[model samples]
Target: MRKRERLELIKKLILEHKISTQQELLDILENAGQTLTQATISRDMNEIGIIKIPGPDGSYIYGLSKDKLRQEGHRIDETPSILAVSPLVDGLEKMIHVDVVPGTSRLIKRQLLTKYKEMIFSLIADDDSLLLVAKTDFYQQVIRQKLESMVVSDEQ
Candidate 1:
């Protein structure tokens, strides 16, 4: 499987179980039909920003890094990243929200596909705007908020 696919699976496993150590995480991967070394699990943990929080048994289970919230989050909305793109289409679910400068849609689209393929399913890009298809509608609001903040930051 691709690194992105592995990461996605890892995320799913982490959410499903209380991962306490590298060995446990590795075992989860192997059970999922992907095997990796302790080093790879370490790297994945860091990359995904996993957190070690105290579990009921007094051991720390890997958890969603709260820092991710600081980085940013979003909610889906009617205004799809751009004017033309939309939630209007049936089965056209959104997965990410990203923004780029005017006339840089193609550039942004390329970069997103290259850099954040895991976070997005499909993409639509136009001048200064981009729409990302996500696994769930929950990400749409996050995308919208992140893009709005970027626009605000640019104005500042």
Candidate 2:
């Protein structure tokens, strides 16, 4: 398998099971017939922006940074980060809600505006989330889909 294929497998493995260490990941890859070294796995993890987050059992599991929702003692969900994609209107009629990694909200907002400047009215950035205000429901859906697509592509 190519490096991208292996990385995708690694992401799948992380999502499927609570993988906390490089050795565990290597063993899983070995079982799947992809022989890779610990160093390679480490490099891949870095390249893919994987981080260890606290699981339900208080053990750390590898996942994308954006996968974490910072609430006190909250356990990380098994669902892939991309799976958290949802666009819901807030109490305000034109406001839409979405979350991203802590530091990248501004960049994502900029990208969203750049891509859908006509549809998106404004973006309100929070600590680790974004509230997108679009011109209409149709425009909101378009914005949501675009944001979700960006996140899903990042996972690859």
Best by lDDT: 2
lDDT (Cα, 0-100) at 156 in candidate 2: 50
Q: TM-score each candidate.
A: 0.43, 0.44
lDDT of 2 by residue, 1-156 (tens): 888888788877887888877898999889999898888998887666566655789766776654233322446543333223554646666676776654445545655677788997888875367777889878877666755665634435
Q: Once model 1 is optimally superposed onto the true structure by TM-score, how far is the C-alpha of residue 64 displaced, in angstroms?
A: 1.5
Q: How close is candidate 1 to the true structure, as a TM-score?
A: 0.43
* Candidate 2 weakest ten by summed lDDT: 65-74
| Model 2 superposed RMSD (Cα) | 11.7
Determine the backbone clash count of candidate 1: 11
lDDT at position 36, candidate 1: 93
Tens-digit per-residue lDDT, 32-114, candidate 1: 78879888887886677665554689756776544443355623222222223333354554644444434345544664567
User: Each candidate: what lDDT?
Assistant: 0.60, 0.68
Colliding residue pairs in candidate 2:
none
lDDT for 5 in candidate 2 is 88
